[model samples]
Target: MSVIDDAIVWLNDPLNWTNPDGIISRTGEHLWISAAAVALGCAVAWPLGVWMGHVGRGGAAVVTVTNLSRAVPTVALLTIFPLTAIGFGPKAIILALSLFAIPPLLANAYLGVREVDPEVRDAGRGMGLSAWQLLRKVELPLAVPYLANGFRIAAVQVVATATLAAFVNGGGLGMIISRGFGLGLASGGGQVLAGGMLVALLCLTIEGVLALIEKALLPKSLRRVKHRPPASVADALPAGS
Candidate 1:
């Protein structure tokens, strides 16, 4: 049988879906670790990005740090963490994944606040709004879409990358793939294919859910409306006074 056919058979088997090492349990483990890493990345990067953008300071620093993070390979981090105090455990995996998630979160957050219209800031100040009030009310509202996009991107990336957890025996969907490979391809090819498909499906699901959330969080005016035919020129004109 073909790999796809075998994968289907493997997936349909009740035994594969039960037990402590089942797909369901592994999926939950995958989500938990991904969530922890993304949350940690947010907690570390978001506020700093917002503050730096608001104050218009450290633009260079933000760029440098973001670039540095992006330049480092996540696999390299995974390999290096075992020698550190973090040890070869879930903490090491989570920390490595969180580091991988930080770049987009930081860059988008900075750009979001920085890109807020200057006129809006001036208008707020003219109304006796303090700097904090202006940022809270004016900048953050305008920046919501950017923030949401960053979060969505980070989340999808983390979900996909969390498969690396199995490399350290951290237990996630990756473990399924690794276990399959351990058993040799001739007998385990079906398991490998099934695990890959599951991870891809999970990533797509995360992206779709987060995209909907991002759309919902947008202002009503900013929400995408269906395209319509142009109105006739007469209809475009105001009624006779």
Candidate 2:
């Protein structure tokens, strides 16, 4: 049979999914590791990015971080962690993936806050809104879409990359591919193909779900509406007259 045909057969086999080391179990591991990593990345990136963008500084810092993240291959980190205090296992994978997740999150958050209409900021300031009040009431609401998009990008990247956990005995879907390779090409090609297909499918599923959520929360009309400061601010404003 062709590799595709063999992969279909393997995927359909109830036994492959029911065993101790099965698709379901591996997928669970993949999601857990990916979630932990993405959460860690968000925790570190969001506040720093938002602050930098809020104050109109740190553009160079964001670029440097983006470049550094892109320059360092995740797989290299996975291998190197084993030699450090981190040693092996899921923690190492999570740390590496967190680094991988940072650049997009940081870039999007900074850009989002910066993209807020300057007119809106002026309107708020004219009303005597404090910096904290402006950020809380005006900038953050407008930037929600960008923040959501960043999360989607980071999450998708994490889910796809989590497959590498197999390399560190982290027990993710990548283990299936590695095991297949261990069996040699002629014997294991189907398994390798099947594992790859599963990872692709999982990534697509996550992306679609997050996109739908972002759209629902920040619908088109709502996204376009500008934030208006309190009546006190508006009343105090000098008329065009």
Candidate 3:
């Protein structure tokens, strides 16, 4: 049978879905780690990004740090994590994945705030709005799109990469993948394929759900601006043309 056929067979086998080491159980563990990483990334990056963007001092430093984090390899971080106090568990996996998630969230939030119109900001200040008020009332709403985008990017990345959890004895779909590999290429190929497909499907589902939430939560005016149709050919043409 073809690889796809084999994977389907492996997936359809009822026995694979119920045991302690089953798909349902592993997926739950994977999502937990991924969510935890995203939560930590948001906590660490979002405030700094917003503050720097608002203050407009030290933004360069923040960008530099974000870039540095991106340069660090995921595997290297996971490998080194074992030597530190955070050794070989879900905590270690979460730490590594959180590092993976930070750069995009920070950069997007800062850029979003920076991109807000100066005139709007000036008007807020002229109206006697305090710095905090200006941020909350003016900038935060404008920055919501970028903030949501950062979440989308970070969450998807975390979900995909959380496969690393299995390597350190952290449970996730990756454990199934590891087990498949242990069984050898010919015998285990179907299991590996199934595990990978599950991760990919989960990431896609997460992206779709987040996209829907973003659309629903966006300010109505902003939503209109985003979804407004382009001018028709007749409308764009010269008068009577």
Give the best candidate by TM-score.
2
On the 0 to 100 scale, the lDDT of residue 201 in model 2 is 90
The C-alpha RMSD in Å for every predicted model, in order, reads: 9.6, 9.1, 7.9
Best-matching candidate per lDDT: 2
Q: Model 1, range 1-241, lDDT digits (tens) per residue?
A: 9989989999999888886999999999999999999999999989988988899876667656655776787778887887799887778889999987887777767877887889988999999999999989998878776677778878999999999877777888998999999889998999999999998999999999997886776777544222321111122335561
1-241 per-residue lDDT for model 3 (tens digits): 8777778999999889888889998888989989999999999989988887898766557556665775787877877886799866777888889988887788767866886899999999999999999999999888877787778878988898888767766788888888888888698899889988987888899889988898888876654235322111122235543
TM-score of each: 0.88, 0.89, 0.88
Query: Clashing residue pairs, candidate 3?
Result: none
- Candidate 2 minimal-lDDT segment of 10 residues: 227-236
TM-score of 1: 0.88
Model 2, position 190: C-alpha lDDT score: 95
Clashing pairs in 2: none
Mind giving the per-residue lDDT tens digits that candidate 2 earns over 18-131? Answer: 788999988888999999999999999899889989999987777677767777878889888877898777788898899888888887788789989999999999999999
> Once superposed on the true structure, which residue ranges of model 1 sit more than 4 Å away at CA?
222-241
After best superposition, candidate 3 residue 67: deviation in angstroms?
Answer: 2.9
Worst 10 residues of 1 by lDDT: 225-234
